[model samples]
Target: MTPREYCKIFAAEARAIPDFGAVPEIIPLYLIYRPANTVPYATIEEDLVGPFERYCVKERDGSLAVQSSSEIAQKCCAFQHWLYQWTNGNILVTDMEGVGWRITNVRIATKLKGYQGLKESCFPALLDQFAAAHRCNRYCEILGLKSLESLQQPAKPKGSKSPSLGRKAPSAQSSPQLQKKGLASPQGTRKGAVSPKASRKSTEAGEAQLAPKHKEEGSC
Candidate 1:
């Protein structure tokens, strides 16, 4: 089934449980790929692969229980089938009992020869299918799951200056100097001669004074 369908089934099944009020916890499925020629680390392989195999076995027997009260066994089985198909049966389950849940741990070791075609086709298709199936927009809200927007650095403001910490003060010699040169001093000028009105008034006053003198001379 498609990833959305899987999620819907998962959600519905989770809702059917007695106390399934919150979203079901999703555990990370780890798969490691390595070259076949190298000697396998037995302890690491055993630690990782054992639990996953046990979980598959228990899940196959209907003994696995999830928090969801609904029929999630079919969904889990389908998921396992898809995983096996993707891995081309090279995937091995290593652990299951430690967490007391049916979460499978997986490991993959590549065979050097006769698997070139399988690796080229199956690996890419598997990744594409897995990406298509489980991808959800809801992961945008998860903490530490960054988005494209988050990857961008914030913009800096224009003309920003560094703080004046532990720097020397400006020197007084740097102050602007007024240039004094051979400039001529302004000479004060005398006021202009009397206005036309004043001149006319003075002439009229002199004529009035001569008229009185003429009238007195005629009387004499």
Candidate 2:
């Protein structure tokens, strides 16, 4: 069944229960095919248990337990039930001398019409679970499935900071004191050309300095 159809069915079934509170959001179910490596028990446990422990309560016997994993337990249990119904417990469930859980029976059901729907909906949800359990993106690549990274939008470049509007713009000609301090220069005097009066005064000053030096040399 397609994920949408399965959700409808689950919702109807849940609503039929008397005294049940409002039906929660339907969790997406995924069929995982682990042909070579089984997903670890720790990974599954952590995904279902670690995040939902806040819902757990202490019993009268002082034992702590939860009714279920937050909302995802519904999805997980449903998927497990579906797997059991389809595979009849003949499927491989392996553990290499207490190393970890590994199921080698996972494969894409290409013949079924609902397969693509499940892949599009359930696979990503399953990938999220795997990712939450610290599985790398290559986990999908190994299964010949699209990784979440492939579907993500490319990161946009950061914008350059704009000038603040509060500060006043500098004027073309600054204060005379600033010019004297060499922090600012008058725009008109930037050219190398010298004024006629200033040039004449400089020439006269050079002549006056040279006359004293020339007189001393002649006297020597």
Candidate 3:
């Protein structure tokens, strides 16, 4: 059965204290409404306390009858089944459920070593954890449980400097050094924009000056 159908069946048919007594036909275990943009823990204490207190195993002998640890253990079993069915073993329960399970596992270990009545100490917290897990699931559904790594801005590489945003920083290599033009620096000449004619004339003049002087016969 689908989880929702299972939940509906549980709400209607499941006995809270394992005995026939007046109980909520529908336990609103799942939160449906809350303040805008806010996620809060589920209100499950009332749901647990009512049925647990009302339908606890009654002693036939005339004495003070209290809730049994066995009943709590039964409730825990139901909780585990629901959790497993709901999650379908795909996503691991973390946060409250995870923490409570850790404690319960330790307690079980201690119980195996001769400890008893651990469920009396463990059940209430487990109920709270179950409620928290429900709340978390609801929150994830509403807000979406996606990896933020794709949405997040990528981190800069290590040791890389950030580009300044306030003002443009001057670059050392941007402005090239001016190339010299002829013997004189022309007032209008740009660094790399030297006139080709002036360059050719300058080369010819330099060659003439460097040539050997020839002595010739006296002219008439």
Candidate 4:
């Protein structure tokens, strides 16, 4: 599907996704078009401005090489994985780009109805290689996207996260000795909570890593 249709469906499906409060919102907007001489219309999108910056979440071949990738970019990668499993591996949108999480110019590699979407980028080999190409990120686990094991075994959504085998999740308790040292003060955040300073530091590192363009991997 074109970005026009794709963005619409993406917004609808994304609503069910857990936002984690702090992650940048994925607000894919409409694709505006203008009349063209040869074609009926020319595809165009709004230009991003100011301190706002564009980011590459994943390459066309599904490489996540940006080691310090922003949380938003990492989240976007998980979105691609979720989309793949949501469609039963029929589609894996890649080459994602946008300012913040307001994405555009994404390429969809689809194997639905025997139709290979995006003739320029979607190829048979790429489809088979995706199982090896993608490496699940922390966000992927948070969203419960099943790891891609093989081409024949298409991943299906594991749905909302729930304990495996009915086992309880680890408690967030801390030892009294640790609390005395202020490592786990009652007034302080629970485990996994990030401080404002640390969050900003991570964001800066991720933006620096994203400054360079991602190299093309494989044929896709």
Q: Give the winner by lDDT.
A: 4
Q: Model 3 over residues 1-220: C-alpha lDDT tens digits? A: 3223443454455444345222222122344455664674444422232222321121345221223244333333343334433433221111111111111111111112112333333223333333333322222222233322322245577885566655785665553442232335665556568788999999999888766443233332
Q: Write the per-residue lDDT of candidate 4 for residues 61-170, one digit (tens) a residue.
A: 55533433778777666666666766676676655665665666666666644544444445434455566667888877766667788535645978685568588655
TM-score of 3: 0.19
TM-score of every candidate relative to the true structure: 0.20, 0.20, 0.19, 0.49
TM-score of decoy 1: 0.20
Clashes of each: 10, 3, 0, 0
Query: Would you give me the overall lDDT of model 2?
Result: 0.36
Worst 10 residues of 1 by lDDT: 135-144
Instruction: Please say which candidate is ahead in lDDT: 1 or 3.
Output: 1
What lDDT score belongs to each candidate, Candidate 1 first? Answer: 0.37, 0.36, 0.34, 0.59
Clashes of 3: 0
TM-score of 2: 0.20
Overall local distance difference test of candidate 1: 0.37
Top model by TM-score, which number? 4
After the best TM-score superposition of candidate 4, give how far the Cα of residue 133 lies from its true spot, in angstroms: 2.9
